[model samples]
Structure formats: C-alpha cells, structure tokens
Target: MASSIPLRPLASQSELQAFYIGKDINDVPKPAVILDVAIIRRHCAAMLEATRELGVGFRAHVKTHKTPQIAHLQVGDIPNTPANFVISTVLEGETLLPLFQELFRAGRPVNVLYGIPLVPSQVPRLAHLAKQIAAGSISVMIDHPDQIDHLRGFRDIAGFAAGVFLKVDSGYHRAGLPPDGLNKGGLVEKIITMEKEGVIELIGVYSHNSLSYAGSTLEEGMQFLREEILGCREAIRQHTHLLSARQAKGKELVISVGATPQVVSIKGLLQGGALSPSRHELKALLHQEDSDDIGRITVELHAGVYPILDMQQLSTNTHTGPAEDEIAISVVAEVCSVYNNAERSTPEALIAAGSLALGREPCPSYPGWGVVSEWRRPKGPGRLIVQRISQEHAILGWEKGKGGEEGIPLRVGQSVRIFPNHACVTGALYGWYLVVDSSREGEGEGERVVDVWTRPTGW
Candidate 1:
C-alpha cells in the first residue's frame, strides 16, 4: 500500500523541497515528472536571444509546464526585457500572480494573454484577474462577435478597455477566423467598432502554425513560419482601410505566431551565409509598409513545448543539435517485471508507468508510446520502447529485428527513464517535478534531484 503521510507531490512545496533537495532522481516517486533545470534555462534564454536578434517580440506560453519556477524563467527575468506570457487556463494565470506582481513593481513591460477565444462566462473571472495584474497586462482572443457581446467591453466594469488579439486561422482550421473570411461577416468592422467604442484595443493578430509539426526538415518549418507571418499580415491588411485615425496611428500592430517547430527554426536567422537570402527575405517580409496610412507591423513569437522538448518535437528536425541534448523532461520509472523470450517474442519489461504516467500521444519518428533514455542515443544494448500499457503498467519492449538479439537491458528492479512523445500533456499528469541538472557534474550524471516545483491542478 502507498504511504499515508502525503510526503511528496501532494505535500506543500516547502515540505517537498526540503525533503527532495539533495535526494537522487531515482529516489523520487515512480513514474514522476522530471525537469532539467539547466537545460530548460538554456533553452528559454536561447529562444529569447534568438527572437530578440530577429527583432520579434516573444510571448512564452505557460500551458506546458504550469509550475511557476519554469514560468518565471520563461518570462525573461532579466532587467530591461519585457516579460510576456500566454496561459491556457485561468488557474495558470492566477498561479503566476506573484510573478506578475514582481514584474509590475519593477516597472518592466509585462503582459499576460488569456489565449482562448473568449466565451461569455469566463469574462468575470478574467476581468477580475486583469484588474489586479498590471496596467495593460491582460489581453483576450476574439474570433466571433458573440464573444464580444458577453465580454461587454471591460471599460466601465474593469476600469479599462481590454486588449484584444484577433485570432487568425492560419490554415489550421483549429480556431479563429480565416484571413480570406475577414470580410465575410463584417468581422473587421466589428473589431473597429469595438476599438471605436472603447470596448477593446485591437492588439493585432495571433496565430499558430501547428501544421508545421507534421514536417520533417528545418526548411519546411521555416516555410510554415513564413506562411504564418503572411497570413497574419493578410488579416491586418484587410482591416487597414477601416481603422480610425487614432487606431491607425496608435500602437504598432503586433503579429504573434509560433508552434515550437516554427520557432525553433528561427534560430537559422543567426546562422551565417548558409541561408543569408532566406534571412534577408524573412526580415523584409516581417516589416512591410505599403503606405503610412497603416501602422507598422511588428512580430511576437510564441511557443510552449520548446522549453521542455520531447520526441515529437525532435521529429520536426527544426533545431540543429543533438536530440538528447535538447529534450528535457522524461518519465523515470522502475521495472516491475521482466518478460523476455518466454511470453514475448522479442523482449519486454513491465514498467511502473502506463497511460496515466506516459501519455498516449504518438510520434511519427518511432512506433511506440515512448523511448527508453538508456537507448535513446543507441549507446547501450538497444532501444527499449513503451509498446503497451494498462492503468499503471507499461510494457518496455524492443522492436522486432532490432536490439541485435541482446534482449532487454533492464533488470527487474532497476529504474529507467522514458522520453515521452508529448511533453505538455505528459507533464500535466504529475503535481510536482523531480528537478535535476544535466548541464553540470554530479555524482549522478543527471540523476540528483535539486528542487521540487509544485503546480496548481485543474482549470
């Protein structure tokens, strides 16, 4: 039976942090979430620097790892840098209030966008959060007029008009109005009317190139980014003639687009000479002004999975680096039983993780739920993958015609780490992360737990 003391994950952060600070990663609970602090820091900082070099704004999404420790790092804590983030849940925004409060006190430029297409019921709570966060801090997404009707404009109620980003479909058909449909139902006129009536300050267009994840090369990812930029531009272009003088000459219209694959490909902008023409073309395309009648077009890049990468992100092949070096989080579980050539044709070991621990999101690169970290780089016996699962059981098996007939390398009680197919949902399974650092030297190459980051649960 499990202990009733409620020691970790369910315990308070202070209690958990005090207990796990100096422990080994293997000492943590089975099938726990693991975060590489150094790797995450490097990934987030590098992304910020790359976007800065490309002259684009960056809005980090907090829907992946909902912990404040990672969220703070993702917000760009350095002085003189504007801090921006988008949240998938109101709880995530509420959970980061202290961080926002700190930034507001320091007078750093800070904004948190509630990144769903607005519905009427969430307005009250969202407006409440807006009232307390910071001036010009809260923004909402709008793709329909009914959403605005229920929002009722935040002017009189919240003491300020809410900032709005018109969601553009970007050919994904996920959400938001398509660029070609801007004039279909007078949506552009509705947006102008909202701004004209002090109902909302049109913050410009927001999009995601999710289709890029299906791509296999960096060039394909870059093409998705270009298409995203063009789609956002087309939306803004459709509305230029209708903007009032103040709205037209007001803030620079910001275009925010990202999917980790697309954002990771932007690092090529700093690569020398190899894609010089592509870089120049992207720069020119990012800033285009047919006439002064329209406001300047600026850009903001947003992504969630780039911080703690996964096998799915690796399949995109956007960033140039070792896969093991970039992928951060993994599921560390112990082998419950070994099923070798007896009942299984190849080799399999029953692990302590199942659908609840390692998510079922599929990756095109491999034919399994997740890959064992031991063989992820193919240095040891062979690749062991989570091929089957129950509620709390996962079969760690090797593919047929593979592993060189050496059999499974795992002992019955030994622990194995798994790189999941989806980092975002996989992380949502645990309440806390067993923090470690793979960037530095230690008794365990990367197996010591340094800190515990607890996250708020549910929406």
Candidate 2:
C-alpha cells in the first residue's frame, strides 16, 4: 500500500465533501486522519461520566475509529445510555446500521454485542446482524463448550437465540472462561443448558483487564478495575444456583469489564465518586456501588481507545492526564527532511507519517514513534518525537536529554501533529477522518476542518 500510500479518499464524497469540509488540518493531504471534534466530545463525555459514577453499564467498543461519528460519540444523546454496541467487525456490526437505525428512531433501544468468540463463519453474519436490533438485540461471545453448539446451531438456522456473554478470562489470556473456571467449566453447564432451552439469551459476565495496558499508576489502574469487578462478580457468583430469576438482576445482569487502561482508572476517582482510603478494596467495589449483589450486576464498561487517546494511552500512566490534554488523535505530518544525527549529533526531522501513517505501535512512555504535537505549538522546552519509523518513513528526533544543540527546527513544508503510538494502530491507517475542533475560538483552533468522518473499512 505505497506509491505514496494515501490509504483512502481519492476524492469524491461529493468531492471530498466539497473540498475538505471546513478546511485546515494543514489544508489536507499528508497522512491526514486528524479527528479531535472537541476531544471527541471530551473523551466520550468523560467515559459517560465514569459509568454514571460507577453505577456502571456502557459498552461502546467499535474497534477504535471504525467510525460512525465516533460511534455517535460512543453512544450518547443519552436517554439514559441506551445504545450498548461492542462489535469487532461483522463489518463493524454492519457499519453500525445507520447509527443503530437512528437509535431505533429516537425512542432508543440499540444493543449489539458480538465482540468475538463463537465463530461458525460468524453465524450467517450474526444472522444478518440480528435482522435489526430487538429480539434480544444480537449478543454473542462464548468461551467454549463448543460455543454452546454454536448457539445451538444458531438456534437451528436463525429461528432466533443469540444473546450471551460468558467469556470470563479475568487475567487476559486473550479470550475467556476462567473466573475460577465458572463452576467446573463445562462451559457453565453448556451455558446453563442453553439458557434452560429457550435456546440462548444469557447476557452477563464478560471480563477484560487486557492487563490494563501494563498500567503504571492510578493505583495500578484502580487495581485493574478492581480485578475487573472481582472477575465479573466471580463469574456471576457461579450461576446463582444454575440461573433463572428473571435471568439475573442488577439492571438485569451484565457485569462486563474491559480495557482502556482499566476503564480509564475510573477517572482517578475522588471528588464524590471518592475511593482512596488506600482503596478499601476498590472502595468497596467502586464506591459502595449500591451496597451489593455487585449492585444488581449491570457493571459493564468496555472500551476502545477511549475516544482516541494514544501514545500507548500516554504510556499507561493510568490517569492519562496530559498529552496535549488527552491526545484525541492526530497525524497531519509533513516537514519531509531536515536531518543531522551523524554519530549522534542528535537533531533530526523527517515526517510523512511512517509505519504506513504513524503506527507501528510502541510507547514504553518515551523514546517515541510519534509525539511532536505541542497542540499547535507555543509550549515547548524541547519536544519533537517519532524518533524513527519505516514503512513510509518518519524520524523527527530530540529527547535524549531533550536535545537542542541548535539545529533541527524542521522546515520543508512544515506541518506537524503526530501524537500517535497506537490510537488503535494510528487509526487503522486512516481512510478518512479529517474532522477537527479544539472547542473552537481562535489561534489555530485545532486547524479547522470540522467534519469528514467516513471510516468503516474491511473487517
């Protein structure tokens, strides 16, 4: 994908939206991608106000920037957070069916889950992505016991029955089944004999600290989201006597937990959602979450680069505070050449976004693969990072003692933003997303271009 790999947009979405929407992200072309949209609505409304202050329930994964206007700002237009999506491709849940059919015509009822696992050629494309929301809104994700006979052979060829979750691997073995092997792992009694033969429809118990990006602080990411909510409430307390009690409660059971550095370390709590008395066991499971039954269990969280944060989520310092105030995606690139490192004279510059547009991911905090974004300059004692990449080249330098023997000040067509090191692999090599908006109002307000989302490419 080279010859000047412009991943997409060979113009024509009504001429690139009549030529670069509101125009600016360096007036387009140069490894573009941009995004921002007011820090993607302040990091998806601060992760839905920290899961409504720990009452919890919020899925929103969309494989990072699969894009439907950031999956409608990670499901918000809240009517008490209705959309629960999770999709890791069935064409990103059928390209988010027109934003879940316009949140099922505003009365809001969207649900999709199919995050992955239970693969019988993805059951007729999740029975055609559950023919549009509602018969238990298409969930999936199993951990074995032959995916409960692949959902009882997809309820014997789509007569309906695809709503499950199970998946427990609390320690991130990658997939699931391990909250102490959920009651002797017969895959939870073959998913409790197909949810007592109604075929399928369990929907609860998912886990995923994905090792909280090897967290560095914020109480080791709130103790890995308090051990992913005590490993999904210890696999939903080992099936409260083989299920069936309105099939579980706590807003009807869904104890999910996932990564984004342990769900953004619950915004380092304190200030009402409290928590730090040496964290009394994650403050009695996230600030007395209503005192028990894991608070009626609906603790979901799932994440996806929490609205475009990167640099390995600011090197997982857990409370990702400042990377130009929470990254929110960037690439823009240009300054194609200005070298000087002959045996370490240290002073470089290259940019044209490498690793095919800023991504070969690797941010053990510093020593780069992208950073240089001083959020539109004027705040630099010494920055400029990237420090070397290849597939389409990068370089940029200066960090060893924050270099400055007075030399590399980049020039050739200067334009730079960068901030990468994995905003979901620098947004899967961009296929359109120039949008911007640092909450506008003056001096380079995040370089104009207020809209052009697109992205919904190959699985």
Residue 434's lDDT within candidate 2 is 80
Candidate 1: pairs in clash: none
| lDDT at residue 220 of model 1 (Cα atoms) | 81
38-156 per-residue lDDT for model 2 (tens digits):
87788898888878766667888988888777888887897745788888877777767778878877878778887877777777667655765556668888877765776766666
TM-scores, all candidates, are 0.93, 0.36
The runs of at least 3 residues in candidate 1 whose Cα sits more than 4 Å from the true structure, single-residue gaps closed, are 1-9, 244-251, 274-276, 289-294, 375-381, 400-403
Residue 199 error for model 2, in Å? Answer: 5.1
User: What are the per-residue Cα lDDT tens digits for candidate 1 across 367-459?
Assistant: 888888863233545566788878788887775436446567667778888889999889988888888888768557667888889886677
The TM-score that candidate 2 achieves is: 0.36
Clashing pairs in 2: 250-296, 292-295, 370-386
Per-candidate Cα lDDT values, in order, are 0.79, 0.73
Native RMSD of candidate 2 (Å): 17.6
Where is the poorest 10-residue window by lDDT in model 2? 1-10
